[model samples]
Structure formats: structure tokens, C-alpha cells
Target: MAAADVIFLVISIIAVGAAALAVTRKNPIYSALFMMVTLLVVAAVFQMLSSPFLAVMQVLLYAGAIMVLFTFVIMLLSLRPEEMGETAPLPQRIFAAVVALGVFALLAFPAIEPGVPAAAASLAPPAAEAVRFPPAAGTGDGATVEFGATAYFGHTIFGRFVLPFELVSILVLAAVVAVMVLAKRDLSKRDVADDGSDRDPPPLSVSAAHAGSIASLATSTQPTSHGPGA
Candidate 1:
């Protein structure tokens, strides 16, 4: 294998290990740190594939933006110290492990037998045909990579994929609205209820019951003034 391939493999392994550590670490902070490590390693791997754009995107989008968001959320949540019950039940954990293992096995079966490159090549043409759309017209830069060019300059944005993009935008807007609603406290009702002046007047019967006695007490309590000459 080429040096680049070996380096990529090493990076991939480190990324996988870091991801596993992130999942298994008991401390939330450590988990987040490990996740950052994994993202950095994955970004390095992307660079090895001659896609500097994707590498930068991986670091900027995932490592910088998403991880920052994740860590900020974790900090905000202020997760309590790990308790015994924090992890999944043993049986469920084991079941999840088995399912993941099975999926890994199924995926690796063909990969190890013939290798990933062959499998990818085999899958590409038919899948491409299935997702076929007209070639996007672009500035005559023949150097444009397939996905980047297609996604950025595609006619489908206004044509076939319009609804999907619109749906995604609506979904994002809804999420923003939900976040605002959650973060803001509605005090109008509470404020109105709490205003002492807005309280119902004392019961008429109760006021009447004490009115005479209070009036008499006030009258009796009034200080008398005698003429100075007298």
C-alpha cells in the first residue's frame, strides 16, 4: 500500500478508538474531549484523501461548530455525577452490542473478501444511475468535483429538490421557534395574578361584620382636647 493509504488507515483507527473512548468514558468532560480528538483525526483522514475542502469542512463544521454546540449543551445541562443507573441495563447493552457487532460483520464480510474499493466501484454506477439528474451547467472549470459542483450549482434546487429544501428550512425555523419558546418564560399571567391591587375586594359580609366595631374603636380611641382656659 502507498504511504498515504497507511497514514489514512492509522488515522481511521485512531478516530475509531477515540470515538469508542468518547462513548465509554465515565466523565462527561472526558467524553467531549475524546469526541474532539475523534473529529480531528477524521479531518486528518479527509485531508489524506486529497479533499482539503472536506477536511476543512470536517474541522470547521463538526469539530469547531457542532462539538462546541454539544459541549455548550453539556455544560448547560450540568449533568450530575455519574450514578450506577446512568448506563443502560446490562441486557439492553449486550443486545445493542450484539446488533452493532452483527452490522459490523455484515459490512466487513464483503469488504474483507474483495476490499472496499471494488465494492464502492461496483455500487457507484448503478446508484448514480438511480439518482440521475441532469448535469449542472457551471463555469467552465473542468476541475470541479462531482458532489461539490452538483450540490452547489444544481438546477434541482429550483426543480425536483425544491420541496425537500423548503421542508428542511421550515424544520429549522420550527426548531428555532421551539428553542425561543423554551428559553423564554411567560410572566404575563403570573404578573397579573401577583399584583396586590388586582386582588378581589374583601368580602362584603366580612367587611360589614367588622365595620361597626372598627368604627366604634376609632371613635373611642380619638384623643379628647379640652379648652386651654378650662
Candidate 2:
């Protein structure tokens, strides 16, 4: 095998291992760190594949930006160790492992075998050609439109799959709006009473209320001194 192939294999193994660790880690912060490692290794694999644009995007979007967001959200939530749920039962985990191994074996058999070419030829004609879009107006008739990485991505996303892409954006927007709505306090219900005469007090933090109660008790229990004549 070529040196490039060996490097790609190593990177792929590291990426897979990091992904598994990310999923299995008990701590959210550690999991996020592992996920960053996975993303970085995947970006390296993209570079090995001669896709510099994809590698840059993988690093910037996944490793840098998305991982930062994920870490921020995880820290903001402040989940306690006790709040984390228990792992799945051993039997259930074993069953899942078996299913995953079966799928991997099914996929690997065709990939590792030497009959892939024969299978591909049987599936489609060897002379089958790719569909190419027309060249730009300034370009000659015989010249085909040559698309770089960014241009090809833009064309695929905005040209043919524009509707789905737009719908995905709308879905993301809706999710954000929903989360904001859920996080907001329900002031409308608290502001009005049954007869619309009394308004409920805003909810106070437990520690603050406890401290206020303690202060009031201390003030009430204080002994008063009187003059001798009194």
C-alpha cells in the first residue's frame, strides 16, 4: 500500500476510536473533547483524500465552531453526576453489538472481496457516463463547466436540492424558536388570578427564600433591653 493509504487508515482508526470514546464517556465535557478529536482526525482524513475544502470545513464547522457550541451548551446545562442516566443493560448492549457486527460483516464482505469490479460491471455498463451541466455563456460550446469544491457544493445545494435545503433551514429556525419559548417563564398565567384581582408573586430561588426566612427568625428572636425605671 502507498504511504498515503497507510496514513489514511491510521487516521480513520483514530477517528473511529475517538467517536466511540465520545459516545461512551461519562462526562459531557470529556465527551465533547473526544468528539473534537474525532472531528479533527476526520478532517485529516479528508485532507489525505485530496479534499482541502472539505477538510477546512470539517475543522472550522465541526471541530472549532460546533464543538464550542456543544461545550457551551453542555456547561450551561450544569447537569449533575447523579442526573446522568445509567448505562443500558448488558443483554441489551450485547444484542446491539451483535446487530452492529452483523451489519459490518455484511458491508465488509463486498468491500474486501475482489469481485467488486465484476459486481459493478454487472450492475451498470462500463461506458455509462456522468451527467454534466452546460458551460457558462462565455465558455465555448464544447467546453464543459468545470466546478471547484466550493462551486460544486454550491451548485448541488442551491441548484438541484434547493427546496430541501431551504426546508432544513426552516426546521432549524423552528427548533430554535421552540427552545426559546420553552425556556421563557409563563408570565401570562402568573400575572392573572381567577378573579383578576390578585397577582401572584414571582417565584424566588430556594436559597434566597431560605436565607430571608432565617434573617426574619433571627430578628424576631432578639431580646429587648429596658431601662431600670421601666
Candidate 3:
């Protein structure tokens, strides 16, 4: 087998494994870390497919920025282990597994079928030998960059779609502000409840109740001696 093919398989395995670990982990921090690993592996796959711009964006947006946001939210929420709660029921988990398998089959079908690639060069091989689209723009030294090249995507995103790009940033900022508001409200409510403000106090334990009863009995008996008028 070719080295490129081996490397591709290794990266694919790492991505899948990390994604699985991320989903299965109980700790939010560990899950976030594993998810970052999966995202980085996906970026590596994009780079291997000759889309350096996409790889960089994946690393920057999903792995770096988004992960940081998620971590920040997790820390702010301060979700405890008890608050994490139990896993889904067995039947629900089974149903989810079935759905996941169906999605996997849909994704793997075209790749697994030999007729598609053999019939036409629909899917190109990876690395430098891969198919190239129309040339985008020429470099300073009279070198032409292809459509899948980084320069092409960068130029298109920054030049023509700058407004949409800035709009997305604004949207992300809005989301962050919304999360902070909700978290602060929730924390205030939690603090109020803990302070016993307008909430019923906890019931006394059996031993405490028994001790109070004994103390009351003793006081009633001793008070009889001092009640000479009665």
C-alpha cells in the first residue's frame, strides 16, 4: 500500500477514535479536549485533500476559538457531577446507536461502492496528484494558483464576502453575550435558593426532632415546681 493511503487511514482512525471518546466521556473538560483532537484531525484531512484554507479555518474556528468558548461556558456554569445526571435509558441509547449507524452507512456508501470511482473519475486521489480546478489568480512571479489553493479561497472570502464575514463575528458576539446573561441569572437564582430566601427550609432530621422533644418535656416538668399559684 502507498504511504499516503496509510497516512490517510491513520488520520481517519484518529479522528473517529477521538470523536467516540469525546461523546462517551463523562467529564465535560475531557470531552471538549477530545473533541478538539477530532477537529484538528479533520483539519489534517482537509489539508491532505489540498484545501489548506479550509484546514486553517477548521483549526482556527472550530478547534481553537469554539473550543475556548465552550471551555469558558463550562467553567462559568460550574456544573457538578450530580448535576450532570444519569445517562439515557437503554432503549434510547439503542435508538441513538441505530440512527448513528444509519448515518454512517449513508456516508460510507459511495466510498464503499466500487462502481462509482471505476465508472468515472468522480473522486480524485489525495496529495499533489489530485484533480485541480480552474486557475484562480496568478502569483507575483507569474505562477498560477488553482481553485483549491489557499490564495483563491482567502481572496474570495476576504474580498467579496467581507460583509458576511463581519456579520458572522457579530452573531458569535451576540451568542456570547446571551450566554453570559443566562448564566448570571441562573447563578443569582441558585444563590438565592441556597440562602433560603422564600424557599422552605430543610426538614429536621429524626435525631434532632427527638432531642427537641426531650428538651421540651424537661422544661415542662421543671416549670411545674415554680408554678405555686397554679
Top-scoring candidate (lDDT) = 3
Question: What does the lDDT read for residue 27 in candidate 1?
Answer: 53
Q: Name the better of 1 and 2 by TM-score.
A: 2
**Which ranges of candidate 3 are over 4 A from the true structure?**
114-142, 154-230
lDDT digits (tens) for residues 1-230 of candidate 3: 99889999999999999998977665666666888999999999998988887999999988887676565555544554445445567898799899999999988887999887676564533334322434444544124455566666655567657899989878766665554454353544644455557464332232222333333322322111211232
The residue-by-residue lDDT of candidate 2 on 4-60, one tens digit each, is: 888888988998999889766656666778889999998888777666678899999
Models, CA RMSD each: 22.8, 16.0, 19.2
Candidate 1 per-residue lDDT, tens place, 95-211, comes to 989999999998878767867678677754343432455443576434443443434334445565789999987876666565545433673454335558556443233223333
Clashes in model 2: which pairs?
none
lDDT of 2 at 32: 72
> Where does model 2 exceed 4 Å of error?
95-148, 187-230
In candidate 3, which residue pairs clash? none
lDDT of 3 at 2: 94
Which 10 consecutive positions of candidate 3 have the poorest summed lDDT?
221-230
